[model samples]
Target: MTYRIGYIVGSLSSVSINRRLAGALVALAPDTLEFFEIGIADLPLYNRDLDGDYPEVARRFKGDVESADGLLIVSPEYNRSMPGALKNAIDWGSRPWGTNSFARKPTALLGTSSGSIGTAVMQAAMRNVLSFLNVPQLSSPEAYITFKPDEWDGDMVTNESTRAFLTHYMAEFAAFVERVLAHAPGHIGDEG
Candidate 1:
């Protein structure tokens, strides 16, 4: 069975490496995973007044988040926290106080950075946000990468070991989503 997974990128910059990494992970997935991109860049800053009844763009973004069986967030650490654009996307999804799209969804986070730590701190920070939003994420086998020039093609993660790790991680995440959805029944987002 194929699963619809949301691949959310944190950065809006035209040259976002994080977005490229998300693309790479999707490519690494076997035929069983159907990954979709969630547009965080086009969304306006979230406001409660816009909840439920949303603008066209907000509705589209929310639909992507709400329908995906699981989430794969590839973020860049912006000033020690997640990028405002990414947070805004999440806020838009986790709205109306109770009808959160991510409530109980299986999610995973990975990031690539120019810095040495490879967005590790940002990953930790996002865990708190995921907890509050009730999105259950894989806590171990953390995924992170420090960008190395001449090491990767655009939208391709080239490190041999890192690629292997991510392939394994994604398979495990697929199983995790299957387990959660089996127990939760209809809560598993869109099973497309």
Candidate 2:
């Protein structure tokens, strides 16, 4: 069965290295996983006042999150933290009290950066937030890629080692999603 995987690239910049990494990861993913981007560029800075009546864009974003079988967040580190736009999207997805779109979803986080540490700091911060949101995240094979221009050709990771690692990561993610979904409440496989 094909799984609908929604991915969020945390950079708004057109030339974001994280975006390229996300695309390459998608290309390396298993055939059963179909990926779609969940755009965060247009989401306004989340305000509690808007919670009572969420904007159309925010509603659409929530719908996308709820519809996905799993989620992938690819982010870049900015000043030792995740980009503000990505945080904003997270806030929106977890808001409107009791309507968190991310709750119980099988999620995976990975990122790329020019720094030697890659996006470690950013992914750590995201892990805390996602934990609070009750997201079931893939905890193994943590991917923190350091971007090397020579190793990449546009949206493809040209280096054999990097490509192999990403391929394994995607396969793990696909298995994680299926495992989570099989046991989810109301899933066909569930005993109840």
**Number of the top TM-score candidate:** 2
RMSD of each: 3.1, 3.3
TM-score of each: 0.91, 0.95
Runs of candidate 2 exceeding 4 Å displacement = 185-192
lDDT of 2 at 104: 82
Query: Which 10-residue span in candidate 1 carries the lowest summed lDDT?
Result: 183-192
Residue pairs in candidate 2 whose N, alpha carbon or C atoms collide under 3 angstroms: none
lDDT of 2 by residue, 118-171 (tens): 899988988998988888899999998999999989999999999999999999
Best by lDDT: 2
